[model samples]
Target: MKCKTIVGLFLMSTLAVFSQNASVVSPNKKISVELRNSANTQVGGWYLKVNYSNDGKISEVFQQITLGLDRADQSFSTALKYLKTSKPNLINEHYSVVHGKRVQCTNSANEVVVSFENQGKSKLNLIIRAYNDGVAFRYEFPEKGGTFVVNDELTTYCVADSTKRWLEKFNPANEGLYTSSKDGNLQQDWGYPALFNTPDKGCWYLIHEADLDKNYCGTKLSNVAEKSKYKLTFPDQWNGRGQGEVKPTITLPWKSPWRVVIIGSLSDIVESTLVDDVSTPSIISKTDWIKPGIASWNYWSSNHGTKDFKKVCEFADLAASMGWPYTLLDWEWDTMGNGGKLEDALKYIHSLGLKPLMWYNSGGNHTWVSSTPKDRMLTHENRVEEFTKLKKLGVAGVKIDFFESEKQSMIQYYLDILEDAAKFDMMVYFHGCLVPRGWARTYPHLMTYEGVRGAEWYNNGPEFTTTAPEHNTILPFTRNVVGAMDYTPVTFTNSQFPHITSYGHELALSVVFESGIQHMADRPEGYQDLPDAAKTFLKEVPNAWDNTKLLDGYPGKDVIIARSKGNAWYIGGISAERFPKNKTLSFNFLPENVKYKLTLISDGEHDKKLVTEYMVVEKSSVVKVRLLGRGGFVACLKPIL
Candidate 1:
């Protein structure tokens, strides 16, 4: 019996963990991760040796992947919680599929789940899943009696000190740039859709969050005490004024959001749906009312000069003329009501076949509304009343802004608003808030999140303050990968000529950026004055796409991407921050057998002007482009008979 007991003990620790070198490959065997425990001399609690397989070359990307958790009373943590954890038994695992309903992306995917547990009475489980696109895992605390306080959740993604890191500040306002670095040095405790570039080893990993609900407050990643490692950090606290320590008290059987790591080439990272896949399935059973498309915005042009019903109607007419679906009424016009002005304007917009998206401050912001903004929507009843009134007025969507807090209370408010908005058959856009972490998947009506330093920054000043070209280039892999971004791109005006990235570069943003509700921030006159090629793109560009392909480029530098919808494809390319003299692209992403008419909207001889070209291209065709100082290009390809 002693002999039998020893044999079982050895098997329990060794079998579930496999070995330090042994790993599990993804279903397609493209991605693999090796697991090992510190009990066996691995430094971390448990290490993940991740490898990527491209063209059959197995490259180890992440050598040390481990995580830990801590509590307030210091009673438990991922490090010591598992110390008394014994038997490390492998529980049952399986494969599953999640469908994206009412969205353009449609597919069936394979997912493999691996679960493990301690055989002792106190059960602390760790579960990991290897999807063809990426890998994700979370801790499971399953005891059921009462509440507990958690101090921290430590997730470490270890990379080489020499690796490239695009670090972003943890501004709750979501306003900042992705300054590049080598040692992962950050000015503040920050988190972003951070990109870790180690191309030589064949891995460009994107770190982000997914499926975050009320269970936990928002999390951002910061550097660990040890060099060459990054760990998860939460807002220190929470209240009305700004972000603060999150109340970590929670009920039994809680889990963390899937800490996601997307690996592959730049294209693979750009086209990943891992965040969407791991998110909660759609809560709205009937989603036909949710629509994704472009909008004409008013904030950029100072609410179209005089925020009245007449000026708003002019913008609505402009939207209809551009074949766009919505016109956003921003500023005090939507909130102050302007003496029943918004109601009249929205009704007129609907008659023109254009929807009206009104803007609102997420309570307690004295900036927009004048009186009783507090008494407006402080409860469930208030939200239902507001949404019901808007639904009756035929308002299609709302842009709620200035959340500025990452507390659980604010997070819960977001869920409550989304639920209430859905009941009224309205689409939603959240601004001045958390970066979208798979909320679009859960609340299909949630179209976009303006957690990006997008075009709105242009309002801060003249040309110099405008959204920089490099910022646009780096977003696809980070912010765009996590979910739809409300960048409010596409500005075509001659007044901002001196500071503008070339006209072609601005045009290219249509294809390069991904958002459910793409907003045109330029003035109405700007749209009317656009070259025919620009107008054509404005009408044809899609807010949601069936597919996306990253052809080539680097982070904070030049990038080219192709996005498709229905039968046509749109491609966007932008120069690096410094702006290049020119760029050349291959039409290889197009089907080899399909002949197509490719129209290129490019920079004119003068950087300030726009030029367009048309050609019939075969599979072998290569197109050379000139991008003078912050320039870019946008093109549309349609298969021709």
Candidate 2:
């Protein structure tokens, strides 16, 4: 990490009735955050305002910012005394990741810390950082060696009521559809990573949090929002079956998670690494054991195949045939039959040179599921015992599922699992869980999370058949904007329920969705029946990307994205409309004056088949393509030597 002092500290008299304000701008000077000590603290204490600059003109993106906290004894929300503001520090650092939208990332921002004293003379600090792509802030306690229970957080984001927004209704599992709204008048509770498009501002921003640890509980935007002001609302008391307190109890010298608002153009929102940039860096120094790859998942197809050892071996064979690295053994592997026992299945999987990822149910009163391998990951001792055993059994990772609560204890449970899994050098994928808030950066082995309404929903009901096409198009801008999402992309065959999306659309998901361990949710036969070109593309496509580019399109209507790995680039486009959509591929993002081989895969005459074409291309080349209604396409570019 590198830092430079940009401005000297300005001290203020520690007076009870003082008026003071401070401001910090991004390195590029395109965004600024202003904090003011309100004269009338009763209404609120230390309000904030965020502004964006365009062509030397300034405009407010967030109308108002509310900050405060209520402790068991003291209230930091209002009637506070003002202290000095720290010097502006330029944070210019670069970090690399194991697997993400990009391999290289930047953490550049200008930060300021403002101190204050509550009515009881207790000290509080507000730390704010302004980045070119967004702004973030968090509260800190300067005192040391004490414990306190925070009854409430008075922080809030005041978006204009007229602003267009895409918000998902709140659910413990964080699995729900994002509904488009003209304003914030719909649901009182909405999930994090909400999307907004400021009217006439040409700016797009996503609201979320980063660096969430065991000390803090996950939060959501509550319609407690008056005048379109969305306040931070804690998880329900019933969370974790009423296990732990919703409010956080913390030791002194602690800081709250960074509340982030990523702002910029659509491309900036899609490609920005601000979430991970602000998160804690990787704790694991040796990450070569944490390999990212495509996994052949059995649940989406068989759902109960782990009980049948023969069926499990078939999928293992399928993975070996596809040249993939891992095979996920879903629930009920404890009751295996046919091909001997769990040990025999592991022997067969290892014989095929593939690492196996086993599944576990996060047991407790929190979830109602009756799956086996339950109660094995709830406590620290249990996780240590189980992870140690799995490590001895040659398991590469664990897909712990059914964690449907977000209370403080549950948050701690999630982190405990990640930390313990790392001790065994095993990767992790969280299912039936909250959306990732940059945990991957903190724990590199924390590969992916299933917090979206993914393909598994197709087997749950009929709604997904009709809703999935539109849902697929909206995710890149909404759910996927925050972190790695495990949507389990690309399935051509139907399970207990059928999908109406075209074969090409299914193929496009391999490139459209970004997951450290991208699970191919199809039967072995489904992949084997594909054309040679399509099969070759699947065999070579990468789950981890070097860079990502949002080429064109809109949410719910259509989308086109290009991702690169080494000298090869992969492009994906999907359409939700009922009619064919035409798009022109632009190669301008490629290396200048470089020739390449282009392999294009598009929807066939019908939904069941796909057609592949080959061509020569370069940086200046433009190719026109069409997608069938409720369909999609995938293309690959390899720089010709």
Candidate 3:
């Protein structure tokens, strides 16, 4: 009788452990995922199997992700229960479209929300949001308010064999050269949102995060655990100043940021709203004062022969002459040699009809000590007073720089500044920071952020070679797809370094790259030498666009894009191949009923010249572009009256 009683209890426990598994598919039936448990095995946890349809054919199987985490040294992976009630059409039930900062935003997908709990002495609950575009899941602590330490995420993503990846060689800083590698041959820990191309299956995948607010530490993929699987890893310690292997300490009832996996073609990857869809909504209810536009920056040209208030004002005057909205005073303006008083510079810039933007160091000059309670200018005690003084002094915005760490405190600082700047009706730009994970939706006062290896590196002769044309071509695919990239385009003449690209290549970048403030990099003297038609094009280039279309893009090779603002259509093409590439461009993408005027900016007959040709063309017109030696081309089609 004792043996029978024990056997009955064991049988019931076994059934409960593995009984709560489920499978879900996208409404369009293109993407699907299945969740199951392996509590009986050595590596016990919940896992996922994903399948994506490619070219109307289902690709090879992608497998398993251990969907769990350890909190305060307790495991939350086994002996789980699935409370199966879910919201499958969360997108449709909510709104379908939203206004965006860079591109047209859409949320017309479906979702499957499943809840789970670990049945241990110290318990935890989780909610998983599976979407057609991607998957976004987070942990929800049940406590009303308390602290919990997250040990690590037990997530693993396995790719198809022989896949090529366009990921950065990882350093503590994301400022590394991106390279192409095979699944079996990775060079280093990759950057966030690693882009992988599966040519055999004709599909692509992007791994990244969203809604990283309220002090959450960012994550990257770990080194390979097998031939094709990579686990989640945390950022390394910098200066012994942050939560080193320990993830953020959560004040509870806390929900973690979304872990997203976007799967599709390169075009779908570029147009994915997975970032914005998962982000928090606007916190500032009255955001009518927020504005995004070009600003004149003197950093790229600060050390060119002279550095002073007079020279600084020259750039401001030029921007005002072009009718640009702002003039951003870049680094070291507070103490640069011969750069006169800050008040005088602001007074002079405002007199020229240019709104003046000043710069501040988040970490207080060159000290490695982190920017927080110690940074006097930005301290909790003094920040409001300083910003109020700037507001009264007629300063338009502030470009804060060097957020050198990705700790929870640094992330909180970003939100803190955004919130404060909004209160004063002032906008901001972030430098040396993480890429946008849809923070713009929450804080419209945040104009742009520089997380890319931008043109500013050209000031150092060796770095001119580093920021290659190929790097520019890859950005529109990997970095710019997620958010605004302050690449600071259009430097006509190279000063301290050798400019390897042709004139047309620089011209096309104005169209290819996306930014709220499209600061032109060259001095006014450079623009003084441009042809009349080229000057007109440069003026129109800074306007915000209503839409963007990626026509042709190959990783680290070439790309062609079409962007529209109002009635004008701007087409830009760039080639980074060793030899010249010639391609035919069709105007059929234009509206049929309207007549148009086309302005083509292409390579000139001589190596040192750029030629612009203007003409009227029909929708059927097809033009050829001969791109040579890291060269490029641009076309502006304006509707006829």
Candidate 4:
């Protein structure tokens, strides 16, 4: 048979089998579902897919299945238990559909609850709930999962409350732009606006998983420009199961997990009730041996080849004087198999009152550390001995480099390294690796990872100018939401020349970006001659924080972030270009009835040749202020009380 005919036959067979076990109990609410047995041969496995209206306003979708043995065991176990027992105990059996209009739906196994109620002229509540193991909170619409012709308009709904507000509140014109559908042809605002509010109402943590086939997961939505497709992936640490494959061999039948989207306006009630029962707050591991503080050399630095014992000691001394705690000796320090002694470098770094960190490749082709080593080199026995030797040499941390391909085998390899490193009390920094997915919480000594596009590219060439802005903006919302990023910050104003942001903007990033060990990404000489004001700002920035708040803005246009370490508050804001009008910043999270001393760096007046030298210090009762064009600001605030 032809390919199209084969696919049509397959889908027809699958749909017919699905229809036998499925039905739409609520057609007006657009809630539909199907369920089958684990051994069902027609579709190759037992499966269920539900597309429903959530809380009357949002439309959502969910899919689950038990296919082959490997995936079937786990998927079937969870699905069966949820359908049979867990869900029935949790759902509110009787609830009001609207004022003076009470409705009751039968409670049954594998049933998903869908309800919609008109709230006001422009607002509605779309709710979907499964008493069993599956559940999701989302914002859905009419044309969901369907193709749209060009120039079509779409309406989006949200709960009208304070706890959860849409991104449109910040930029009214951009709201609902992310949800529109688009044809194969390019056009702007093809997607819709989406946000997720959880019981954990602090920062938005997003997980995106792309399969080896490059199939993107997550909620399908449009972008403001309406030219692209966007999807969010479920958080899977093992990236499914087995190496290079999502285990269980199940096709589309398995419901991976709910793709959660929260309308912030109704965050409090929704987060408390709608989030999946399986989702929980992260649990961070204990780091008994690893110490947290500033570090000297990062993965990419200029002073590598020329530094001898004397120069190394001088740099260590400078770092010690600055109240920084550690120093690093990166790649090439070891001669691989030629026998370089790590003791000599460790001794000198320690002599300067700074802890020492060394670099090693996780699994590479180098003569010293090859993935497929000849003789005893590739075995775990030999690697453990090498790690033991490094530990004796006083190495506090090991920077593991170059596990470039994120395959299942590589994931296992890194997990093994983290386990072995823990045995020797050595901390780890992963380079050329994927973003952290709460790994730091599981292995605290895994200080940071280099999945982000960081400062190293800036020194290389022109690509830095184009990519840095969006990368910086999206990271906090996506990657950093889960854990720390080892993005080396603070390249001096002079080093970046004309392409860089002003010194103040650079200075502010130390607080804006979240990392465990924030490296001073510039050379020692870069900050040596900076003004005293800028110098003081750099010196006092902290690497860790007790809390962080995204005050306003989005990925590309602009972003403002505030973090607190102890009593001090460090705020940083950046813009893509000089805006024609001023933007007002709000500080609603600050403690009320208290005065603060604000020291700010912004655009200089006409006379100041140094564009970054502008400073403002004032006592402020109101936490709102207007920032100038193309202008960014960094401020350090200490409470006057």
Please tell me which predicted candidate would have the highest TM-score against the true structure: 2
lDDT by candidate, in order shown? 0.72, 0.88, 0.71, 0.46
Number of backbone clashes in candidate 3: 0
Worst lDDT window (10 residues) for model 3?
A: 93-102
lDDT top scorer: 2
Off by over 4 Å in 3: 1-21, 39-44, 83-87, 93-104, 121-126, 129-132, 199-201, 224-227, 239-246, 304-307, 336-340, 364-377, 461-463
State the displacement of the C-alpha of residue 1, model 2, in Å, after optimal TM-score superposition: 55
**TM-score of every model versus the real structure:** 0.88, 0.95, 0.90, 0.61
What is the per-residue lDDT of model 1 for residues 1-641, given as tens digits with 9 covering 90 to 100?
99999998988786555562235556667877666666754223666678888897876678877765665544333343233222222322321222221134422233333333333334455556666677776677766766677777767777776788887877777678877887655535666788887746477888888888887888887675755777777775533464334756677778877888888777778888778767787788887788888898877766333266666777788899999998988856634344347667776888999888877767654223342234344468988888888888888898887777777777888898898888889888888888878887778889888898888676665643444777888888788778778888877663332346777887888888888888988878877888878897898788777667888788777888888776688888888666456677787777878888989888787766888899988678888888767788888899997
Relative to the true structure, candidate 2 reaches a TM of 0.95
Candidate ranking under lDDT, highest first, comes to: 2, 1, 3, 4
Q: Alpha carbon lDDT of residue 271, candidate 3?
A: 61
**Alpha-carbon RMSD to native, per candidate:** 4.5, 5.2, 4.5, 14.1
Please give, for residues 203-283, the per-residue lDDT of candidate 3 as tens digits: 788878788886567777776566577777666665224434337777777777777778777777776667777778668
Candidate 4's TM-score: 0.61
Error of 3 at 205 (Å): 1.4
